[model samples]
Target: MTAELNARLEPTGERWTLVFIRELRKPPEEVWGALTDPGRLERWAPFTAERDLGTTGDTTLTMIDGDESTPLPATVRRAEPPHLLEYTWGDDLLRWELEPSGAGTLLTLRHTLPGEDGLGPMVASGWHLCLDVMERLLDGEDVRAVRGEEAKEHGWEDLRDRYAKMFAG
Candidate 1:
């Protein structure tokens, strides 16, 4: 079978990275709080992450879907209050960097997945959706409907295109 396209931005450079940046309407501390809080994660993404909102280390994010759940074991590599948070997601290094953007906060997500065994596209899609949800959550808007619409529109072709573009760029 062929590989899937990315759900968000295409990969770039030799690093095989998927990067997404969004300016949250809220301040840095509020944005950071939302991201760190596990209860807030579920409201946006379809996962329940278990970890200390203040301390960062080895944390497990269990994806919630119906009655099933998949535990994604990860380790926090770095953490700086209301600024930066970097972690390992499977074979990829996921980094969440926040910056002051006027009265709002600019949040950038960078994911680096090594190798090219088709995992890049898969993870990109998830990040895209999660970022969308995060955006909605920051705006205090309902994200379930938005996620459903995005899934309906993109599907797998989007995933493959994302990877192909990453390879080309």
Candidate 2:
């Protein structure tokens, strides 16, 4: 299946915010579980949650691949369950907002980066694949985590080129 690259980039002061909006066929609560539950996240997320992330606290996010799969310290800035969640990962902040839309959930992800720095398209491409995997999972389809060479093999390079053009101006 062809992945859809539907993220928007906005300049926010010294930083740039990349927003990904998705309309899921599942409800907010179900989507929330996928976002917070470790078991469900492992099927789609790029990292595994070491603990429950439904509360505002600290947790470890273990990288799913790479030799540097070491757990990273992460802080939950806010959590509202089935609605809103904000957290920090490395030098960036990630926020997820869910809202009921029709019979499904409208999920919005706001990823704040220090700067555009030519990484916007690359990052957007990665998130595009992750979100695609998540949506497929929610739809009850068997999907594997896409990354590295697998990502490029599955049209990630095309997405990167599209996003690069989108973020160019």
Against the true structure, what is each candidate's TM-score?
0.73, 0.92
- Give per-residue lDDT, candidate 2, residue 83: 100
lDDT of model 2, residue 79:
93
Model 2 TM? 0.92
What's the CA RMSD for each of the models? 5.5, 1.6
- State which candidate has the highest TM-score: 2
Task: Compare the candidates by lDDT and give the number of the best one.
Answer: 2
User: Stretches of candidate 2 above 4 Å error?
Assistant: 66-68
**Model 1: per-residue Cα lDDT over 1-169, one tens digit each:** 2122323444555556667666667888988877778777777664667875446688887766556677888888788989998877666677889999999988888878787535666665565666666767777876552233345364535754665577457
Tens digits of per-residue lDDT for model 2, 38-96 = 88888888788987788999888876664446577899999999899999877788999
**Candidate 1 at residue 133, lDDT?**
67
Note the Cα lDDT for every prediction shown.
0.67, 0.85
Backbone clash pairs in model 1 (N, Cα, C under 3 Å; residues 3+ apart or in different chains), count: 9
Worst 10 residues of 2 by lDDT: 63-72
- For model 1, state the Cα shift of residue 145 in Å: 8.9
